[model samples]
Target: MKAARGSVVSKKGVPWGTIISVVAVVALAAVVVTYYLVQSAPKRALASWAPTADNPDPSLNIPGIVTGQYQASVHILPTERVAYDHSPPYGGPHDGYWAACNGVVYPVAVRTENMVHSLEHGAVWIAYNPDQVSGDALNTLKSKVEGKPYTMMSPYPGLDSAVSLQSWGHQLKVGSATDERIDQFITALRTNQNTYPEVGASCDALGAGAFDPDNPPPFDPTPPGPDAKPMDYQGSAGTQQDTGMPSSAPTS
Candidate 1:
């Protein structure tokens, strides 16, 4: 039907394809932004809580954190153990050989004495009660320690809490692996110059005969015998070289 000279042509349906494409792009952009925020939020929070002269021990601000005044440079032999005042002790006399705490996660319970030495070297030890933590809960704790220097995690049988974090003279026990205080404790104490005894100590194992991370010494759950080393017992002079002490004076 040939109409008059100029008939108006009307365009009917909406541009559905174009609209859908725009919506998809917008959704993808939103997801990317959300992920960035989620990943960086914790780091930002930790930076704010970093230790400063005014806040010498920022871990003190963390709720339920237990602080102690254990003397440094105290080391015991591998065959000896200390009658630690606290369960999964935060500090005190420790084994002469420090555990391999450079982001190592032990599948079995490690000797507390060796682990405590790692703490003195400014490493944060994450001890979880195997009976209480497993599966996702266990993995969640591992995520905080694995591949993160100055950090290590191990199963501690008979642990009073589901999770316990130890760094030098500090300790924090939480009921679950998802506790926010876990990161806070790590941020404040791991390698904090004022808190730990050794400032720039190495978290690596000495070697095969020393503290082997793969086949480390088994944790003895038995109560420390009467002959166990006392808290005030000064360490042997032979092991002092491994304390990471600078040629100058040592810090508390």
Candidate 2:
């Protein structure tokens, strides 16, 4: 069993936790929103990494879901000269992902400061489709390459969003992969059947995360409830910063 997030949460604003609701988790098409909570921890704050606001590569069509605004823009980034500054991947036993771009193979999922820094942590891979992306957007993206390399990441609205992911872990809200591996991953976290070691993905699953479980809940893999609302949220970046995009590497 993983240690409770509260135990690691620092008195400072840096919290390694903020129990995520089932809706948000499903919405993100991820193992759980526990990732946010984990980053809140002080020890975990500078743990990952953030990149230079610039890089020079445009082939990868990216999108920055400006949470403050409902709009998304196209951006670009150069990945060849990457670096890791802080901690490595958080969750234990998480799978590593891989992808192929123009006949090139790259590790899509692996926990590291470089992953988060490049905003390449959760990039998705979309089978190249020209119509999915307009010509104007593509040309504009290329033009912005060197001056603001990472700027091309944010694709304009209506590009099916997940159009570019040459580098990160792509967070999905809903659709397609839901019934597949996503559901299974959530199920494991819901019940004690699985554990994250660092992040707590509880849904009162183990009796509200056990204040201090001298004797924790039994290991049961069933989900709490189909439509469970973990809790209310006050902050939601209306637009997804890194989402529903395709990528060359597997998302961890």
Query: TM-score, each model?
Result: 0.82, 0.18
Candidate 2: tens digits of C-alpha lDDT, residues 66-168: 1111111221122111121111211111111111111111112222212222233222222112344446644433332323312212222222432333223
The weakest ten consecutive residues by lDDT in model 1 span 243-252
TM-score of 1: 0.82
- Cα lDDT of candidate 2 equals 0.25
lDDT of 1 by residue, 1-252 (tens): 334422433343577999999999999999999999999988987886789988988888898988898887777667888888999899898877899998999999999999998988899999999999999999999899889999999999999999999999889999999998998998888899998878888998777778899899999999999999878877744453474442232222
Runs in model 2 deviating more than 4 A are: 1-117, 120-129, 147-252
Give the Cα error of residue 173 in candidate 1, in Å.
0.4
In candidate 1, how many Å is residue 152 off? 0.8
